[model samples]
Target chain A: MTSLPATTERRLGLVIDLDTCVGCHACAVNCKEWNSGAQDSPLSDVDAYGADPSGAWLNRIHTFEVTPEGAPAQIVHFPKSCLHCDDAPCVTVCPTGASHKRSEDGIVLVTEDMCIGCGLCAWACPYGAREMDPVENVMKKCTLCVDRIYSETLAEEDRIPACVRTCPSSARHFGDFNDPTSNVSVLVAARGGIDLMPEMGTKPVNKYLPPRPKTNAATRTDPARPAAACQPDTPRPEGFLGWLDAALDRLG
Target chain B: MHPAISVIFFTVASGAGFGLIFLLGLGFPVGGGAGRAFAVSLAGGGLAVAGLIASTFHLGHPERAWRALSQWRSSWLSREGIAAIATLGLFGIYALVWMWSGSRLQILGLLVSLGAAATVFTTAMIYAQLRTVPQWKTRLTPAVYLSFALASGWLLASALGNHAAPGPWGIALVILAWAMKWAWWVRAGRTRLADSGSSPETATGLGFIGKVRLLERPHSGENYLTREMVHVIGRKHARKLRGLALALGAVLPVAILIITALTNAPAPVNLLAALSMLAGLLAERWLFFAEAEHAVSLYYGNR
Candidate 1:
């Protein structure tokens, strides 16, 4: 069993660099793999490898077409998941002692055995991080892979979370948020990052590095034309082939 | 703010139970049949308990119900539970007083019963005050809850009045409650929808300037929407259901009660009105829950 880190005033967390992120969804996939077989497997699916596949994942990618108010640009991909907020709404809303935020690490966690799966925590959460496990009939969410990050048996460099460890693009960083000198804290201070839906007042611990200034100067596309462009204006050719062409052209 | 069915039923049932007991308590000194008061109280109490039991079904761990009463400071549910228990206790005490003595403790019973019913009224306001859900936020909710209880309570009292009191008094209370319910329905129908934090325009802090389309949802599948707001009815179907609830719950029952009252109808006719009102109230309660749209639905790209 992995022993949790020693007592601390405030627990550390992640600062994801959205500018560096390629919207790969690798973090989400690996997180599912790690949590599914871990001590308290956090990931769950309603119907997997079938029609209407659905489940809970700690990390999720949301693509948002962010055209800055007055600027001409392309759509920006926005991936959102748990920020593991310092003032988590999920923790306060839990009727049972199921959802909690640890003072030691600032990590929001759900105790499986205690969870009644009332779906209250999910409602409380604005980010939609928590999910219900149909088989276990309890709530599940990101622990930030607490087991691997704190285990003394692991190498010093390998003590980071699975998502941070596996991030190929080096977009995610994990360290002590309490320490001002910490790498994650420094990067946040230097580069102006933003929290998703900050107006919701969650005070999310994780900081998303804002989308970089648009680089493609030549390729400026109108934001509204994508839906309109999907329709074809030209008529078809002839008989059977013409009908097939019309169907094919319509899908363009 | 997913309003559990148990809680909804509990509020409606207990409200009616206490309302009936209060009105009966008002005219207790005029000594009549012992069985009459007992039957009305039992009917009212049965409906109230039925609602309480229905709410327990919504609990994640129904076995841990006892623990719910402990969190009185923070949880409205806890306060509701305590208030409900107090209501039941008062009802029991009143029942015993009516059985053991004549009209000795009638005033005290009336005071306690009215106090308990007022507490249930506060419980209804708890949901109504939630600005997050525009449907519940309306002042009409408390009025509707109060009217429904009064209507049901009087309807039951009318049944008991067949043997106990003069026919006109019971019919008058029923008519008053019936009118109150119709007025409530009209006000609630005119109530406007509140803006919940569901839209991307609201979520992103961006005004409704540019057309903001959902490129992707954060998760793959149903997290809470498929669970809480899973109930879906088409616009036509919803319209039909609303019409049915209004006709049966408010209009039809009121019409039946008025006809009975005006015609000096028999006991069975009055009983039929009570039964019809009960049936309509159940359908009305169902619509109240189903029709409520949570602001959270906006995050799922629902307008």
Candidate 2:
């Protein structure tokens, strides 16, 4: 049924560190690469070399300007995917009973055969976690790598989700949130990880550790210049105007 | 909130169709005496089926649409499908019985009427339940839907049933429907992410620091999220469209109906009113989709 499970034996999800994600799309790419062949290859890309290409992707990264109070703004690389909320609106809104949450692990998955591709589930999701594949005509979303996480054939190191395994900076951590001693739960407690939209009442399983504060601006002292590059110079005759005049005279 | 033509036609056409059915199922006198009973039933039933069919056009797998009926336990969309089918089925029996016997079944007619109303309510809930759209997630959404359905239902029945002008009650319904729509638009203007205690800050969980803004989006090219959710109509164009919709859908039809009611104008004037109203309502439905700013668009900094 599309109805969500009231409780699961384990809440398995990811903890993303906004402090370290570097805007690298390797997670997104490895995710596409592995999951493309995971479940009948629902994720699709259109017109790779063509002029206008549009398709579905399960994961993507965004960069944001986070300005701390009374401090300079910082750029944070944000990697976004399905948070697999305890109150998953996308699952309940599915008309076909194709979208459902597992009672065992609380991992949300779609039954591809039962999907009608109406796209209502996508609309219900506030996180843009679900994507409707233009080619296969099915709603594609993060399965939390349900196949890989419990696979027996793969090596022990390969048991984790492809995205978590491949992140260079270890920005993404996967573990069971139901266990207090798990790495994800420990990190959440240690770094004060937070939910994306708590006001939505979705009760997202995944949490994000905010970027650490950098109080002062960078002051690079290059040997050639031997000056603090962070200092702002006053606009006088000896400043930008003088340089502009010299450059204009050289052009003339 | 891209206003796909297929879904727009589905909602508008089906709303009007079910509205007409609502009137007929109330034991109206039209289907009793004359041979126009089949025509009336066809008008209502045919449009409902047509709209339902049109809805499938925008679906990725129209062939799999039959499976949508399975999840009525939780989904409003499924409930709508079930209600629509049940109403039409009961209506089929009721219309056929009346056509053969020429005597109205009051009890069955009442059932059909209730079914029609319930079906329309479910349709409204499909949009109203979306918290992802704060503009639509309100009581006003369903209220406007019911009012418009009632108004359009009366107009269609007036024009198509007896070729006569609708009475004072119908005219009042027209006024009420447009008034409700006007109120909805006013409220919609004030509905923002902040109203739901959601903003760029809450969306990022970075509000305690300061205001958060999107520096770079996830994709340089258009993805499904950007294409489907970020449809934005300019404020000036939206204002113009609203005016055009009100004038045509509301003012013209109400004016024509009133003039015909007072004077012995030609019966075809009702037809003109119906056409004008349909065109106007189409524009209104288009605006309904075009103006909806999805919450996901906040992540992309589009809204």
Candidate 3:
């Protein structure tokens, strides 16, 4: 069962846009809040209040500064999690058949009961997607909010993942990549979305929208110049008469 | 790439045990008597079993170790488990036949030897198959493992062999292993794969725009990924360890074995050669894990 399926019916994945993300950690915070109470609940933290605090988190955001030769520097915020690849190494490397990719939805998941916590799956992952829960002593990773996405009780709009829902900039998009007309697919095509580390040959389901190129108009501006001081047009009048005229004009 | 002591002990001890079994299986039918052969078999088997057990010490749930044998079709670790068990079973049958029938089952001995060798190969493949660690994803990795196993096996066998003086075969094997390890070092040093294929730019998919560098880490403290994969050793320290490994694992053993062969030295000298080789191999194994750079470390700015 650890072997991957020949093909999945639907490839549900995320397309993250780098152009508008503010790196506010909202997605990561919402993900922790949701997954900590949802399926395989309670992502515990060890020494949370003490000197050394650590815990398992499903999504993480990293910021980078890119400076090209003879070009303006740009800041990029990268949110990373499991790509749920077509050929996930973590699934194949699991000795207990614990880690598996769903043939129906193309979502990679781990069966907690079957896992022996040997940490082989974590080693096999190239993206650093998986994290070991120090308190539970088992491997945990992004499940893509499987429970909420399929629930009938929640409203249609609320059925998306917590991270996607909580993103203030709408940087994360979730939909089926298999459907050409899907919003995610259309966005990907329009922006020329790219895979992270394609050389790794993971065929990751998730894609990243590159930062939009900065235009010359946006970066261009005119230099400031000093203005000549104003002078009174009628200065020959007597002081009382001038003062009265000025005061009458001001009042008028 | 933390080089946990449990795994280091497991690989080294198990490799040496399988190597001894490989040699003993071939040598037992030819010259060694039943009693001595049985004793040697017990020692080798015991070492291998102990190593397998030691491997579980680092696992979160040691009680679930039996479940690891279920996924042999895809996982090298699972295949290693099955092969180790099969090797033990085959050797058990061979030992029983020798004890009960007082006859060496030549065919069974051959099968057991093949099983032992296969087990060692599977163990090596566990690391070799990992594409995430480019240094380990090579044919040279397995070659080094097999050579070291054979070299240590021959050293141990030389000490226990029935002859009054140790054979030259052990020394020859040590030299061969040394040569192979040296070649591996030279090749690995020149290969780009030893570093990460994924850099900060590639990891973030922002390379097309410009040169990418980490501005801030994802978290303030170390996470599981950093703790498990991001190991950094100083260049000078690594160089010193490599020299130490070469001296203890190959040079010292080969020299002692050659001296013993020339002087017809006593059994103690052969024992000394085996001990020295083992000590050297331990250092070598430690470096193998410590020096390996995982692709995941790119995200952590370790590259």
Candidate 4:
């Protein structure tokens, strides 16, 4: 049997790598799939695949076009969800002790039995991480797939959350964040990471990797295919809209 | 800060309730010829009680309302509840003094009524003190609630004025209340979004020294926003509603009351403005909740 401490660790967390992330949303999809099938409570969809399609998703990705003060524009895709903070405002504000942070593992979880569905937690959280499952009438979020992570039936490599395991680029990592030597800790140290909205002081455990810097030299030429070796499928337009002319020539 | 209907009814009912008592304690004569100032005070007092009962719906455990008074040290809800009870007690004493002493007790009743009104001001302060919620954090919150109460109270007085005796006091208080409402709207408009980085870097307590991007969410199920922020509303709609509230709550009522007070317009006009003020206050309360962003929304990168 998995020890209770290991089953629920105080240092539970995730480490995302921005450099390798393709923003394919596999993590979000797999997470939806696994959570909807969980025993504790399954996320539901009301009028799903219809006009009023709505369902629970612990994680969501947002795309932003960042034009740094003096730099050229760059596309930054962000996948947002809960940070399971040490001082979760959602937990503290809950009138009933429904919302709580695990002492053994830093995971913030809610007990369905105690939740009154008042939604005070939703207002207290700054990250917009907490969501109410209408069907169950309780709050739900990323559990780090607690049921599967330490299951003996699962293979050691597959013991991680469905989101981490399904990631094609190995961009997602999970471990004991308290240990300085853990893989996530090493990755965070080597490639600096940042937390969202530090001023609120929720003290979230998850770390986000910063987007890689794109230099002028890197953008001036195509690294994947040499410019000289590239064959034009179509004649190029000169000056304005040259790319559009080249594409037309290729089509012709 | 979604406005719960229970609270809306509570504030409005209690506000009008206290305002009526404040006016009657001064022994202002009504020209309406009903000659029942004492009865009007009792009715208004009853409304205040009704409003308090409605407010209980906002609590998780209505049965434990007594326990709420224990935490006045830190909880505004507790403070508001205590003030509410005190206001009721003062109103009760004012009524007893009025029945027994008549003009001789008027001074004492006026003092108690003012104290009761002060309690109502403290009740408004309860929601205004939550610095974490920027929308309620404004100094205008107390002024807005108090003015709203006075405006509603004055309007109620005017309705009963015709039955007892007509006077400029009702119309004057109505005009003053509307002025305060307009000032609150102007100040509320000036507040700007102060915090950003609903991103992980800011929310997770990580340093600001480096760039931060979300790679994977900690979980996969929908949690709170899908339920709360899901109340869809656009900036255009919010702006339009604000204009409507200001016109109805402030400009219209003020205009009507001034016309009646100055030109001696028919009783119907004053009566119309009083009813309009009640409806306008409700809309204003709704906007207060809808426009105000909760601190929790910061996590969703909404900032």
Q: How many steric clashes does model 2 contain?
A: 0
State residue A104's C-alpha deviation in candidate 1, in Å: 4.8
Model 3: residues with Cα > 4 Å off, grouped in runs: A217-219, A222-252, B28-35, B163-165, B192-197, B233-236
Candidate 4 error regions (>4 Å): A1-11, A69-72, A102-104, A144-162, A215-223, A227-252, B1-11, B14-133, B154-180, B194-247, B251-274, B293-303
Interface RMSD of 1: 5.7
What's the TM-score of each model vs. the native? 0.75, 0.92, 0.92, 0.68
Q: After superposition, how far is residue B220 of candidate 1 from its true place, in Å?
A: 5.9
Give a tens-digit lDDT track for model 4, residues A1-252: 000122334488898876677778898898889889874778866666555556767877655444545555555556666777766766655545556677787777777666656565666666667677767766777787887887999889889988889989888888888888998889889888666666667666888887666667545866677776476666545776887777876999
**Residue B47 Cα positional deviation in candidate 1, in Å, after optimal superposition:** 1.3
Ranking, DockQ, top scorer first: 3, 2, 1, 4
TM-score of chain A in every predicted structure: 0.78, 0.85, 0.87, 0.82
What residue pairs are clashing in model 1? A11-A105, A62-A78, B6-B55, B198-B298
lDDT of 3 at A206: 94
Best by DockQ: 3
lDDT of 3 by residue, B127-205 (tens): 9898888878888888888888888887777776655445577777888887888887776676534354667777788
Per-residue lDDT of candidate 1, residues B1-303 (tens digit): 344667566766776676666556565332355675567668767777777777777655667666546545444445667777777777777776776664437666766667656656766765664443455656666766776676666666665655444345555555665565566556545542333434565554332234455666665665555456533442225567666766666566567766776777764566666676666666666666566655445455552
Instruction: Please give the ranking of all candidate structures by TM-score, highest first, separated by commas.
Output: 3, 2, 1, 4
Q: For each candidate in the order shown, give its overall lDDT on alpha carbons.
A: 0.64, 0.87, 0.84, 0.65
For residues B131-203, what per-residue lDDT tens digits would candidate 4 score against the true structure?
3455565677787777777767776777665533233565566667667766766665664334332343444
Ranking by lDDT: 2, 3, 4, 1
Encode model 2's per-residue lDDT on A1-252: one tens digit a residue.
988888999999999999889888999999999888878765788996799877787888988898777678888889999999999999999999999999999999988888888899999999999999888888999998988989999999999999999999999999999999999999999999999988778899999999876646456444666557656886457688899978987998
- Tell me what fraction of the real C-alpha contacts between chains A and B each candidate also makes: 0.23, 0.86, 0.83, 0.19
